[model samples]
Target: MIALSDTVSASSDLLSTEIDGEVVMMDMEAGRYLYLDRIGSVIWSELKRPQTVADLCQSLADRYAAPIEQIECDVLDLLQQMRRNDLIRLHD
Candidate 1:
């Protein structure tokens, strides 16, 4: 399971591009394409460098008006999905 203390970063194996304010990524190893909305794109950009889950939530909370708890939940869900797709790596 992912925790707020865990560090996350984008996988080095992805080739991604931005279009129409969204992001499209291709996982080279998996040969799969993934789409990310604006918010997801923001998260992806932030993951260029490893960031703690708590730091990610705090960053999102600053940029968005959502509550910290909601941001945390949403970030966790998205990160989980990203992990499953091999788009991100987690470092405990």
Candidate 2:
């Protein structure tokens, strides 16, 4: 399981493109395509550089003017989905 202390980054192998404030990514290895909304796109952009999950939640909370707890919950869910899709890499 992923923890807030863990570091995460986008998988470098994906082929992605941005359009209308959203992002579309192709996981070639998985033979699948994924679409991200504006908020997801922001998260995806930030994940271009590896960062701790706690830090990412704080940053997003600030940007979206939301509570850290809520942000953390949403981010954790999204991160898990991304991980399952092999769209992200996690570090201890």
Report each candidate's C-alpha RMSD, comma-separated, in the order given. Answer: 0.8, 0.8
Q: Supply the TM-score for candidate 2.
A: 0.96
Q: Against the hidden reference, what TM-scores do the models get?
A: 0.95, 0.96
Candidate 1 lands at a TM-score of 0.95
Q: Residue by residue across 1-92, what tens digits does model 2's lDDT show?
A: 78899999999999999999999998898798899999999999999999999999989988888889989989999999999888999886
**Each model's C-alpha lDDT?**
0.93, 0.93
Location of the lowest summed lDDT over 10 successive residues in candidate 2: 58-67
Error of 1 at 65 (Å): 0.5
Off by over 4 Å in 2: none
Compose the digit string of candidate 1's lDDT tens values, residues 33-74: 899999999999999999999999999999999999999999
Q: Which ten contiguous residues of candidate 1 have the minimum total lDDT?
A: 25-34
